[model samples]
Target: MEFDLKKSLEILDKTPTVLEAMLQGLSDEWIFNNEGDETWSPYDVIGHLIHGEKTDWIPRLEIILAQQGGSKFDPFDRFAQFKNSEGKTLHQLLEEFKILRKHNLEIVRNKKLTNLQYTLKGMHPSLEEVTLAQLLATWVVHDLNHIAQVARVMAKQYKHEVGPWFEYLGILK
Candidate 1:
C-alpha cells in the first residue's frame, strides 16, 4: 500500500492533542516521576519520543521521499538516547517534540508524496528492508502505540484510584 500522508497527519494531530490533554494539570514532579525505574521517567519517555520524531521518523521519511534504495538504516535506540540527553525538564522536551512534530506534519502535508515507492534498509541488529508505504504505516502505528503507553504510564503513576475504571473495561489491569 502507498503512504497516505493525509491519513497519517490526521492520526498524528489527534495523538498529540490527546497526549497534551492527558498531561494537563500534571505537576512537574508528576511529569518527571521516576517510579517506573531508573531508566524511564515520564519525562524520559517524552524525550525519547521527541528524539524519535526528529532523528528516526523524519530521516526515514526523507529516505522515503528521496527513494534511497538498498542502503542500510540504523534503527533508533530511544531509551539510550534519551537517557544521555541533557534536558532538565519535561516542558523543554515537550516543546521540542511539538516543534518537530509540527515540522514533520508540514512536510507531509505540503509534499506530493502519494504513489511514491522507495525501499529502506536497516542493519543495527540485523538487515531488514521496508517500503516507503510500509514505513509510513509503521510510523502511524508507532505513534498510536506510544500514545497508549504514555496513557498507561500516566494511569499507573498518577491515577491509581481511577485506573480501576480502565481495568474493569479491559483496557488495563
Candidate 2:
C-alpha cells in the first residue's frame, strides 16, 4: 500500500495510549520479565521506544529535510536503553514516551510534507539511501513491532504454564 502520512499518524498517535493501557500499572513481573537471554521486557521496550523518539525518527527526518540529498544520518545506538533507562521506572518511561511522541508528531505535522517531500532521500548509516516515505513507514511499523515484542515477551512468561495450549498461541512462537 502507498504510504499515507495521515493514516500513519492515526496509528502513530495511538501507540502511547495503547502501550499505556496494555502496560501501565502492571506488576514488575509483567514490566521487567524478559524471554531469557538478551530479550527485552515491556518496560525495556518502552525505554527503547523512548530512545528512538529522542534519537532515531525525527532526527533522521530532519537530516533528510535539511540536506535535500544524500544526508548521512548519525548511526542510532539500538542498545542505549540499557544505560539510558537506568533508574527509570516503567511509569516514568511511559510518561516520557507519551510526551516525546506528542512532540515528534507535532513536528511531523508542522513540516506539511507533500509527495515530493516523501520522495526525498537520506543516507542511512548502513542501509544506503532511503526515502522519507520509507523512514516514516518504518517509524510507524517500528512502534508496532516493539509493541508486539512486548506482548510476546510477556506471553512467553506463561509458555510452560500454558502447556498443551501453547500450540494455539502464535505469540509465544
Candidate 3:
C-alpha cells in the first residue's frame, strides 16, 4: 500500500491511549513482573518508549527536516530509560510519554509535509541513508512491536501457571 500520512498519524495518535488502556489499574507487581529472563516487563517497556519519545522518533525527523542532505542521527541508546526513568512511577512515565507524543504530533501536523518531503533522505548511524517515509513508518510499527512485546512479556509471567494450554497460546511460546 502507498504511504498515507493521515492514516499513519491516526494510528500514531492512539498509541498512548492504547498503552494506558492496557496498563491502567495494574499493581506495581503486575507492571514489573517478567518471566525472570531477558524479556522486558510492562514497566520496562514504558521506560523504553519514554526514552524513544525523548531521543528517537521526533529527534530523527527534526534532523532530517532541518539538515541539507540530512544530518547523521545520533546513535540511539536503547537502554537509556534505565537511568532516565529513575525515580518515576508508571503513572508519571505514562503521562510524560503522552505529553511528548502529543507535542511531536503537533509539530508534525504543523509542518504540513508534502509527499516530496516524505521522500527526503537522512543519514542513519548504521543504516546509512533513510527516507522520512521509512522513518515515520518505522515509528508506527515500533509502537506496535513494543505493545505486542508488553503483552507477550506480561502473558509469559504465567508460563508455568498456564501449564498445558501454553502450547496452544502462541503468546506464551
Candidate 4:
C-alpha cells in the first residue's frame, strides 16, 4: 500500500498509548523476562525504541530533505540501548519514549511536506537510493515490529507451561 501521512501519523501517535496499555503496571519480572540469551526483554525493547527516536527516524528524514544525494545515512547502533538505559527504570524509559515521540511528531507535522518531498530520494548505506516515503513507512512498521516482538518474547515465557496449547499457538512457535 502507498504511504498516507494522515494514517501514518495516527499510528505513530498511538504507539506509546498502545505500549502503555500493554505493559503498564507489570512487575519487573514480567517486564524483564526473556526466553534466553539471544532475546531481549520488554525493558530492552523500550530502550531500543527510545534509541531510534533519538537517532533514526527524524534525523534520517532531515537528511533526506536537506541533503538528498549528498550523504548516506550513518549506520544505526541497534545495541546502544544496553549502554544508554543503564540504571533506568521501565517507567522512566516509557516516559522518555512518549516525550520524544511527541517532539518528533511535532517536527514532522510542522514541516507539512509536500508529495514531492515524500518522493524525494536519499542515499542509505545499505539500501542505496530510498525515498522519503519508504523511510516514513519504515518508521510505522518498525513500531509494529517491536510491539509484536515484545509480545512474542513475553509469550515465550509460558512456552513450556502451555503444553499442548503451545502447538496451537503459533506465537509461541
Candidate 5:
C-alpha cells in the first residue's frame, strides 16, 4: 500500500495515548518490575521507545529529507540509552515522546512526497540508499511494530487469569 502521510500521523498519535494508559497509577516499584533479567519492565520499555522515536527514527527522517550525505549514523542502542538516562519516572519519558511525536507528525504532514527523490548514503556497517517514499513507509511500519509490542506486553501484564472459569467448566482439573 502507498504510504499516506496523514494516515501515518494519525496512527503515530496513538502511541502516546497507549503509553499514557499503560502508565496510569503505576508506582516506581511496578515500573521497575521485571520477570527476569532479560525482560524489560514497563518503565524500561517506555524509555526505550521514547529514545527510539526521538534519537533514531525522527532524526533519520530529517536526514533523509535534508539529502546531506556523508555523516555516519549509528544504529541506536535503545537499552543502552535508556540505562544511561537519569530520569526517575516514566512520566518524563512519556512526555518527551509525546512532544517529539507531535513535532514529527507535523513535519510528515507538511511534506510533499510527490516529485521528491532523495538518496540516503551510509557505508560504515553496510552501504544503502533509499527514496523518501520508502523511508516514510518504513517509518510507519516501524511505529506499528512498536505499538503492537506495547499492546502485547500490556495485555499480558493486565489480563486477568481465567483458571477459575476453566475449572468450573470442567476444562481443567
Candidate 6:
C-alpha cells in the first residue's frame, strides 16, 4: 500500500506498546535468545530501535525539510546498540522507545506537511539521495522489520522442540 502519513503513524505509535506487551518481564530465554551469532536478541532489537530514534529517522527528515537543496545525512550506526545497550534492561528500553516515538510523532503532526514537502530531498550516506516520503516510509517498515525479527528470533528458541512441524512453521525457517 502507498504511504499515508496517518497509516504510518498508526504503526509507529503502536510499536512500543506492541513490543512491551510481547516482551516485558519475559524470561531471558525469550528476551535474550537468538538464532545464532550476529543475530539480534529481542532485547537487542529494542536497543537498536532506541538508537534509531535518537539518530536516524527524524534527524534526516529535518535536514530535508529545513533545506532547499537538502543537506547530507549522517551515516546511521547499525551496530551502536551492541555498546549502547549495555546495562539497560528491557523495561528501560521500552519506555524510551515510547517517549521518543511519541515526541517524533508530535513533531510530524505539527509540521502539517504538504504533498510538495514530502517530495523534498536529502542526501543519504549510502543511497546518495532520497525523499522525505521514502524516509518516512522506511521509518515505518524498519519498525516492522525489526518486530518480525524479534518474533522470528523468539520462535526459533523452540525450533528444535517443534520437530517435524518446522516446515509448517515458516517463522522458524
Best by TM-score: 2
Which segments of model 3 are wrong by more than 4 Å?
none
Q: What is the lDDT of residue 122 in candidate 2?
A: 94
Q: What tens-digit string does per-residue lDDT give for candidate 3 at 126-165? A: 9999999999999889999998988887887788898888
Q: Residue-wise lDDT of candidate 5 within 23-119, one digit each (tens)?
A: 7677765566654567776677777766776676657666665656554456767576456446555777777778878887776667655544434
Ranking by TM-score: 2, 6, 4, 3, 1, 5
List, in order, the clash count of every candidate structure: 0, 0, 0, 0, 0, 0
**Per-residue lDDT of model 6, residues 15-83, tens digit only:** 999999999989988998888888899999999999999999889989999885558999999999989
Report the C-alpha lDDT of model 1 over 39-98, residue by residue, as the tens digit: 455666677777778677767767655544544466677676456457555556666677
Winner by lDDT: 2
List residue ranges in candidate 4 displaced over 4 A: none
Quote the positional error of residue 91 for candidate 3 in Å: 0.4
Error of 4 at 68 (Å): 5.6
Q: Candidate 5: where are CA atoms >4 Å away?
A: 27-30, 70-72, 118-127, 157-173
Between candidates 3 and 6, the TM-score winner? 6
Compared with the true structure, the alpha-carbon lDDT of candidate 3 equals: 0.88
Q: What is each predicted model's overall lDDT from 0 to 1?
A: 0.65, 0.93, 0.88, 0.91, 0.63, 0.91
Relative to the true structure, candidate 5 reaches a TM of 0.71
Candidate 2 clashing pairs?
none
- Residue-wise C-alpha lDDT for candidate 2, range 63-158, written one tens digit per residue: 999985569999999889999999999989999999999999999999999999999899998999999999999999998998888888989889
Alpha-carbon error at 42 in model 5, in Å?
2.2
Clashing pairs in 3: none
